[model samples]
Structure formats: C-alpha cells, structure tokens
Target chain A: MANEKRVISVIVMNESSVLARITSMFAARGYNIESLTVAPIPDSDMSHITIATNGSSKVMEQITKQLHKLIPVYKVIEHEEMVEKEMVLAKFPIAENLADISVLASAYNGGVVNVGKEMIIVMAADEPKRVKHFIEAAQRYNPCEIIRGGVVAIER
Target chain B: MQMSGAQMVCEAIIAEGVKTVFGYPGGAIMHVYDEIYKQDGFEHILNRHEQAAVHAADGYARATGEVGVAMVTSGPGFTNAVTGLATAYMDSIPLVVISGQVPLSLIGTDGFQEIDAVGISRPCTKHNFLVRSIEELPRILKEAFYLARTGRPGPVLVDIPKDITVETGEFKYPESVNIPSYKPTYKGNKKQIVKAVEAIKNAKKPLLYIGGGAVLSDAYKLIREMAEKTKIPVVETLMARGVMGHDHPQLLGMLGMHGNYASNMAMSETDLIISLGARFDDRVTGKLSEFAKYADIIHVDIDPANIAKLVDVQYPIVGDVKQVLEEMLPLLEGVDPDRYQAWREILKRYDELHPQSYIDSDEVIKPQWAIERLGELVGEDAIITSDVGQHQMWAAQHYPFDRPRQWINSGGLGTMGFGFPAAIGAKKAHPEKTVINITGDGSILMNMQELVTAAEYDIPVINVILNNHFLGMVRQWQTFFYEKRYSETDLTFQPNWKALAEACGGIGYDVTTKEEFDAALKDAIKQNKVCFMNVSVNRFENVLPMVPAGGALFNMMLPSPELADSALEDKKGTK
Candidate 1:
C-alpha cells in the first residue's frame, strides 16, 4: 500500500508562510512526500503546488482533507485522471556512445537537447513513472551528473 | 478611518461580537493592552499566567458555545500557553490566542522577549497568522475568529509584531470572509444517510456511540429522537458524558477505558454502531484491532479526515452531526422494535450483574462518596469542571450531568491544571449558574495561582479539592503496571490548600468526614464568593472498573477484595 504513488495539486494564496502551513500539516500527520514542486500561477495572487506521496487510499484521503482545511489553500485536487510530468537531465561523457543514449531517451518520448564538448546533455519530459525508468536505463552510459525535477501535474 | 493595529484589533473583536477575553499583559504586548484599557465594552480577565488565561478562555468557549479569546505577549508568554492551546486543540474547542511578537525586523535576530510565536504554536493550532503589516491586521483577526469557530472548531492564533501594533493603517473590518476552501459540509450526503438508517433499522443489535461532536453540534435532541424512534441503545464517550439523562433506561453510561461495564459489553456485542461526531480515540477504542470487531460502523462526522482514520467506516456520512441526525430521524420512523428488545434485555442483565459501585468506608472519606454527595448537593444542572486524575474519573463516574456543557473537563489532552481556571471561565460566562471545579491534590497546585484571579475578579467558582496527598492516577498505574515502584508519584509535601485559599482572599474549608464534607460544601455554595473546600480522601483508593491500557473494554478490572467487601456491605445497607 505504501508503494502506491498519489499526486495531489494544491491551489493556494501566494503568500509567505502559506507553504509552511500546508507542509507542516502533512509533517504533523507523519505523511511522507516523495516529490514536491511549487510555482506562482500566471497573472494571479495564487500558486500551484503538486505533491507526490506514497500511501494507501485512506492516507491519501486524509492528506487531501487536511490540505483543504489549511487557510491559504484554495483547492485540493487528487488527480483521478490527469497529465503529470517530471523532467530529468542526464550529462554523459562525450566519449560514451551518443547514438545508443539518444535511442534510449527517445523511447521515453525524450532526446538529447544539447551536445557539449565534454558531455552530452539529454532531457526527458514524460510521465513521472517513465521518467523514473528512463533515469534507471540511462545510468549505464557513465552519466557524469543527473538532475531530477519534482513532479508537476495538471488535470486532463 | 486610519487606526493602529492595536485599535483595529479592538475594532475587529467588537465587530466579531467578542465581549470578553482572558489574558495577561507584558512588555511585548503593551500596545494592545493599552488599547484595551482605552476601549469600552470589552471585559478582560487578567490571569496570573498565560497558561491559565488560555484555559479560562477555553472553558468560556466550551460553556458558552462562543469563540473564546486569549491574549498574551511574545516569547515566554506564548510558550507558557502551549499546554492550554494543545488541550483546546485536542478537544476541538473554539479558541483564539492573540500574541505579541518582536517587530518585523528583529523577528529572526533574537531580540528581547522574541520567539517564533506562530511557529511554536503551529502544530497545536488549527491555523495561525503572523501579522507582517498593520493593513492586514483586521483581516487576520476576522479570519482567526472565523477559523476558530467554524466546522470542527479548534484553536487559532494570531501573532502581531510590536511595530505593526504601533503602525497606523486604514481599518476596514470586512463584512464577510471569502475562504472558498474552508467551507464545511453541513448537509450529509443523502445516499449515505439513507444507508445508515437502513442499517440501523435492520440490525438486530444497534448502538448509538456519541462523542463530543454530538454535544458541540447540539445533536442531543435529534439523537434522542432517533434512539426512541428506533429503540436503539445509546452509549457515550467521556466527552459526551451527558448525552442522555442519567436515569434514562435506554442510556447506557460511558464506554471505554473508565466506562461502565454494561456499556462496554454492549459495545462488544453490538451488530451495528452509529457513530456521531466521535473519533475512535485510543482511550475510547482501547486495542484498535479488537474494538467493535464484529460491528459495522456508520461514522457521521463533519471532518472527512476523521472518517475511516482508525476503524473501517461502513457508511461514511460527512456533515455536521446535528444536520445529519435531523435528516436521518424521519427515515428511522416505524422501524420494527422487537429485534432490539432482546439485545436490550441482555445489556440490562449485564448491568444488573455488575453495577458500578465503590467502597464506602465510615472511618475515612472516599473520593467516590465525596463526588456522589457533591452531585446530590450541586444537582445535575450545575456546571462541573474537573482536573485530570482519580478525582476526574470519580467525578465523571459519580456526577450526573443532565445537560450539554454542564460537565466540562480536559477530555483529550487531560491537562491536570485545567479545572480551576476553566471553572472560573465557565462561572464568568454563566454568572448565575453554580460552577464547581472538582480537583485533586496534584492538579490544584498546577495553576493554583489562578485563585488570585478569581478572588480579584469576584468570580465565585467553588473549588472542591479531593486531597489524597498523592498523584492518584499515576500511583494507581505504578501499583498495577510498574510493580509498585512508585517513583515520584507521592505528593505528601503538598501545601495547605485551605490556608492558601484564605490567603488569596477566598473562603476556605477543611473537611475530613462525609458530614463535614456536606456541611462545608453547602457553606461554600451559600457563601456566594470564591470558596475552596478541601475534602480529605483515602490516599490508597483507586478508581474501580478501570480498563487497563490496551485491555478490551469488556474486560475491565473491578475493585480489589478489600474494596469489594466494603462495596458489598454498603450495597446491603442501601438495600
């Protein structure tokens, strides 16, 4: 049950300490968050936040309800059907086979976005699950560094 | 219409219909206190400590069903009120604490009497605000009131910086708040309500498990109607002590750790449980896996998170308890009552077999006897508050509370010093009603300084001290669980409470016998001013019918052999 991942998007008033209030609630309840991201919405005094956590249906329900209780939180959306994405950038040594890395990244709807003298930078923007798998598959190319962005979600 | 933050606070409080606030003043909060001094129509009860102020405010809120307000300074002042805030938070009482903070610039620089007021109080509060500007003071204050008193009420805190309190800003108290996410669901889902009603009607053994939520939501009348219409037996949790009259045939006494035997047994045997506003707390549920193992639970609570948090709720109705009960009552009419009669008879037999009785000794006064006698004199309608311990359990067991809010105790947090200050708050809210604080030796000393507050303010709340000269509850636990290694539970060096009360300008009495107790209690009630009565009780006595921690509710430990013999003798005499 703990392995089942849940994605929840919270719309909140863009204010100081608002994020603390929401995150503290989850911490107080001892809920674990796997990945989180927050950014201000365009042309509004609000922010969009996405949290990925592992819990059963019951824990997810509790997390959602508690999030709704926070003052700054305008809405809590537990995605039943949604388009979610995570970005990962992997830098591989230039001497490593570039053709094989491109094929592996392309399989996950991703490809090399940059080619440098010292390293080849590959970017993958796909489902969080696939992005996770892509990182595991590209680990063999002697990747110098890997950066994983937090999950960002939108309702379909 | 420009005003300082302090003045706007006063304005917002007035606009929010807050006529009274319990608080203590200090350097950090001087501006607000100064404003309070200049303002009219607000009664401020200055308590000895910040902790007691919050407790008094909590007591006021619980007794009056209004949002109680408490104000204090920064740093140590806010930290001192942490226990009171936690108590109110656990019990879901509506309270607002306004604290002073260091000026915005010195917030993180470690200035004099500065602490992270909001951060320290975050976990214990339902929500909190740290005022960064004077312009937002009015809105924050308004929101604080709304949040504290709204659905599943809990405490909220507002921390104001010293500079903000002095800075002037345009004061426009909003006529209404627009928190779209904070709306509480009042109307229960129709499908769930119907399903719960059907389950109740068809079940052979149905029980109504009432909690503090039922009392807070004022669902007593609706609960009674549902019980009578459906012929279902009802059992209450500690917080829902007076859900039904003590003499009601269908009303089983409280269930759980210190609950009545028959009620606990009935809970184990029930086929369906109609839970109203009561969370399945550890104390109430005992062993989680063993709690109501055979029954299908129908949970009706306003907080969606509360549903199925512990027990698997078969029918979850997310709404206010009162509104849900109102909607479910009509659906329960004309339900066949024959099936429940047999279950009722079985429960009646269980009650008859093990009546809740305690040892009555003629040589020494017993705590149970003192409480029973006190109940007779005070009557069921009198408001009673209790500190946590053996005395609290005795009071809950012996006192017959006939109305909602009549019996107020620190249920969830079980804070020891909660009784006296809370009784002061209750008495202040209901000036004509008699308010009694049933306290113990250890608990009375926790916040005994509040006696000066009562004496100064002319709040005539009766303090009944069951002086056993030991921390009775811990002593009992040590005796049972720790192999009689009584660590630091002994409290023989306690102060002379009677002399202390007298020194504080309150009348005091020392009673050792039942006759003396009766006389002293009557005298205290008649005096009409602040009075404290110290009733000496047997130091070794333990609360009977106690369910050991993690023990099944149905499997309760009864009185020991010596006490059992005394109880039998007393029963024979009564017969």
Candidate 2:
C-alpha cells in the first residue's frame, strides 16, 4: 500500500511529557511527522496537538489506535473533512519590488505582517497545500528567509 | 479532611478494595512506601525485580478480574516495568502501575533516579499521568484504577513526584468520575444485535471464534451457552484457551497459527465467524486475504476500533461481550438440530483424520507428553500460567482448561519471564487453588530470581521447567526457515535449575524420564511448598501442527514426518 498524507488532532490533558510521549510513539514506528503544532485549548486544562504524517490506510489505523491508547489523550480526530491551514512568513530585502510581494501575499489571503528598514516580512495564511505553493511562487523574489507555522486543522 | 498525598494514595487504593499490591521500594518512592507500611489493610509483596512486580499485578488482575496494582521507583525501576505494562496492555489485562518520580524541583534536572516515566510508558500503557499537585493526587489515583479496570480494561500508570507523596492536601475521594470523552459503550446496538442473529440463522457452517475479551468480560458461560444454543462449533484463540471446556463436544480446538487442524479447517470453510471479545490478530488470521475468505465475520467487542480494524467485519456489534451475549441469546431462541449436522460430520472427519499426536520416546521425555501428564496430574481445576514460546504453545495445546482464568500466559507480548511471577500472583489471589508455572529452560532463566521471593513469602506454587537446552520456539523457526542455522539459540549454559531452587530455600527435582517426571510432579504437589521440577525433554522435538507464518490457517503443517516434509517442500516451491 502506498503512503498517503494524514492529519490527526489529539485532545489531551496539559501535563508534562505528553508531547514527548506522542512524538516518541510516532518515531518508534518510524513514522515521520511532516508538520506538527500544539496549543493549549482556551479556558481548559487540555491542549490540542495536530500532527501531519504520511502512511498507508493500514498504518494510519495502527497509528490512530496507538494514539488513542495514550493516557492523557482524550480524543483523536482524523482530519477527514476539515478546515486546514498553515502560515508562512517570507522575508525580502526592502530594495526588492514591494508590489510583487504584496500581490503574492494577497493571492494567498495574506498581507504584510511587519516591515523593517532593511527587509520586508510578508505573511500568508492559507491551506497547507496552497501555502506550499505560495512559498514556491515567492522564491522568484529572492526571499531571504521563510518561517512556517505547522499545519493545523479543525473539523468542518 | 486533610491528608498527605501518601495517605491519599493509601485511601484511594483501599477505597477501590485493593487487598494486595506487588512492588519494590526505592529512594524515590520511600515516602509512599512509608505510608504503605503504616497502612493496615494492604498486603504488599516485595518482589526482587520491578518487572516481576508488574507481571504479578497483571496476574492478580487476570485471576480475580480486578485491577492489578504495582509500584516502583523512578528511572530503571520504572523502565524495567515497560515489558510487563506492554504485556498487560496487549492482552487488555487490567493493571495500575504507580511509579515514583523525582520531586517537582528535581524533575528534568538530571536528578538522581529521574526519568520520563509517562513518556517511556505512553505507548505501552492505556493511559498515564504525572501528578502535578497534591490535590490532584487522589483524583488521579482514583482515575488510574477506574480507567485501568473499565472499558476494554488495560494498564494505566500514574507517576507521582516524591514531594507530592509527602505533601498534605484536603482529601475527598470522588464517588465517581465522569470523563466526558471516555465513556465506553456497554450495551450493544439492538439493531446490530438483531442483524447478527439474522446472519447466524442463515449460516449453515458457522464458527464461534472467541478471544480473551470473552474471558475478560466473564462471558465464558454466555459463550458456551450461545455456542450450545446455536449448535455452532467453536474455535478459541490462545487467550481464550480456558473460556471453553477443553473437551466440549461442539468445540474445535484453538484456531490460527499453531492451531488445531480441525479448528483451522472449520474456520476456513465456515460461512460465518462470530468473533467475540477477540481481535483478528495476524497470528489468528494468517494470510489475511485467505483467512475465513468465505465467512461473513460478526465481530463483537468492547472496543469499536477493534471491529473491522484488521479484516472486514460484516456485522460489528460494539459492547461488552457478556451483555451483548445476553441480548443475543433470546434472539437465537432456538436453532435447528440438523442445521449443521453435515458440517459437523465434515469437522468430525477432519478431527479423526488429523488428530494432534506425537511420537513417544522412552529415553527422553517429550515436552508434549510431560504437559499432558501434568494436565492429568493437576486435574482440571489447577490455575496454570506459562512463559512464552514452545512451552506456552504446548500448555495451550496439551492442557484442557475447563474454566475462564484457569490458563494465563503472555499471549500478545509473548513475554518469556512472565509465568513465574504471574503464577505467584495467582497463588496470592487464590491461596487454595493449585497454581503452576509451566516454563522452559530458556524462559525460566529470565525471572528465576522470583523463586527467592516465592520462597520468602511461602507461596507454594509449582514451577515445571521443560528443559530443552535451547530456545525451543526460535530453534524450531530456524530449523524450518533458516535450514537449522542455529545462531545463538542454544542455552547449554543454563543454570542448574534444581540446584538454584534448592539454594533459594525451595525443594527441587531433576527428572529425565517420563516416570521420573510423573513421580517428581506428584512429590512436588504433595510437599505443598515452592518446588521446581526440571524435566529434560527432547531437545530437537518441535511444536507440531504448525502453521508457517503468513500461510493460510487451513494450510497447517502436520506432525507426521512425511506430511511435515511435504509441507516444507511445498513452501519451498520444490513440491
């Protein structure tokens, strides 16, 4: 079976080593996470962890079962139908064409997040797939550095 | 009322009706051990090793159908228990492991005996916790037991900082816990139950495939009732060994790899497979595509993920097996007496054609013969536990367990040293029952130190070692697949087990002949103190009627030399 990308978000108690446990479990299985993100759920003693990995359906089932078995994990949601997004910030010399970078950011439903004397930081928030495309398209502008926040998803 | 976290730990476990705990004390857990010492209700067994402590707890849980509890110190003490935790987890045995952690200030600072207990155990345990505060200690401890014993029943670990154990807090043991997301489905869906009944009614050649879940849910009687009511021949998995009577007329022996020919063949040809409390493990479902290819699988389990997880299950009923069977029995109301008479005749023919048999030797005792003899001597009521490998398979095949929990072994993890400590725990749970650890030369060496503990505690359990001088199971695999490339499977340097037992203040016997074995076993049972009987068996004799891994269940390798050779030649593409 060919490996396919899968995103799973786990709701877990905000406690020590929970993240280490989750990540090590994936590592033990030799399943690499393409992207990962963790943030405490507002007004709750829990956190939401989103992990993106590639595996076959069978492998995915095993991973899901393994995740569900973790002690702190309360819920594991597979992003079958969900709103997924990623944010990428691209930096360019202030001398670079500002109009082109602005158009590129706007195309990805984003805009300039910060500006400095020597460089311009443009941020784009969009679906993870489009975010990858945006980074590729912005490469023509001779970007200095690119910072990416990992993929996050919520059920639609 | 205000209570120290250590006192709360005692209260919480006492509230759960825990009468015994298996553990080893160390610096990190000194405070909790102090409280345990002060506590009057709990009977604590100090194991020589942390691994055995967990296995003992697992044994206690399996025997009593209650949550088994084990405690250990941080770092290596906790790490040693990973195998035991994983063993219980895979088999869905209820166990709660209480691990001592460094104080909060010392955590993650490379403090003495510091380790990420929760992280290390997360994969193996069903759930784990790090108590951050004393107030949460009681609730977390309570939850640990609750989660360990509820739902599909598995191992849970709670890592407590030493400071928390010494710290004081208001103690309030919650009458109940309501985890919003953790409620397990108990009642099977009525519509699904009805659909299963309809499928059963339509199946001419139906097979009842029971797993450990039936035993865990105490549904053995219900399973037997259902099987008898429907006249469906039953096939049990390794964990489900004692769930059905060994000699039940309608029962085909265990199924899948190393399963009986009649059972495996019946499974392959059956039109429907009613799987209760058993996952379709790869070992049970050899060559998945060819396993029960003709059958519509009706899977009934407490865990929803288990259903249709491996193979396609047609009718998935998610609930406790005992409760589901209760609902299902009325639906089956009555079945035709002659419905599967022809199917039964076919199974009977297969049983007669390929009966489980082995050649007897006067010089060297056969492992199978020793097990059969032990079975005869122990009667049907003895609670038997086994270490993993050839010995375990022999025990399952040779011994006829007529009740649930009568046969306990490390099924999923295939742990080697599990039998000795587990047998000890079983004896502690049922002091009147005859507890025996049927082990092997290779496996007995893994946790033989527990013999000292057994002697110290006066646990009068029998340790029957089938001395084969080699890792029998691995050697068998090598013999077949690797053309006898023995590698390091030989265990000629094994300790003189009889001498070792005697040195540990227990009686010991070394038997080389069948007659010696019978006499030694009888003598050991009569003495009623911890006894080790090392019986030398044929070193080259292999567990037979084997199903080569990834081969279809119906494609079993028989015991007869000629048949085994043909099967090997066929697998090698030389037939």
Interface RMSD of the predictions, in order shown?
A: 1.4, 2.8
Model 1, C-alpha of B434: deviation from truth (Å): 1.6
lDDT per residue, candidate 2, B1-575, as tens digits? Answer: 99888888888889999999999999888888999988898899999999999999999999999999999999899999999999999999999999999999998899989998877787788888989999788788878888998899999999999999899999999989877657788999999999999988888999899999999999998898888887889999999998889889998898878888999999899999999999989998899889888999899999877977788888989899999999999889866747988999999999999887777767778888888888888867699999999989989988978899999999999999999999999999999999999999889889989988999999988999988888989988988899878899988987777789999989999999877888888788889889889988877777878989999888888887543332344455663
Instruction: Please name the candidate that would achieve the greatest lDDT relative to the true structure.
Output: 2
The 10 consecutive residues of candidate 1 chain B with the worst lDDT sum are: B561-570
Note the Cα lDDT for every prediction shown. 0.88, 0.89
RMSD of each: 3.4, 3.1
Q: Which candidate leads in DockQ?
A: 1
Evaluate model 1: give its lDDT.
0.88
lDDT digits (tens) for residues B1-575 of candidate 1: 99999888888888878878999999889999999999996899999999999999999999989999999999999999999999999999999999999989998999999998788788898888999888788888989998898888999999999999999999989888887667889999999999888888789988999999998998888888778877789999889988786777788888889888888998898999999989999888888878887899999999888898888989999999999988888887758878799999999998898878886789989889888887788786589999999899888888877877988999999999999999989998999898999999899989999889999999998989999888989988876788768899888886777789999989989989888998987788788878878888887787878889998877788766544333343456587
Alpha carbon lDDT of residue B260, candidate 1?
Answer: 82
Stretches of candidate 1 exceeding 4 Å from the true structure: A92-121, B562-575
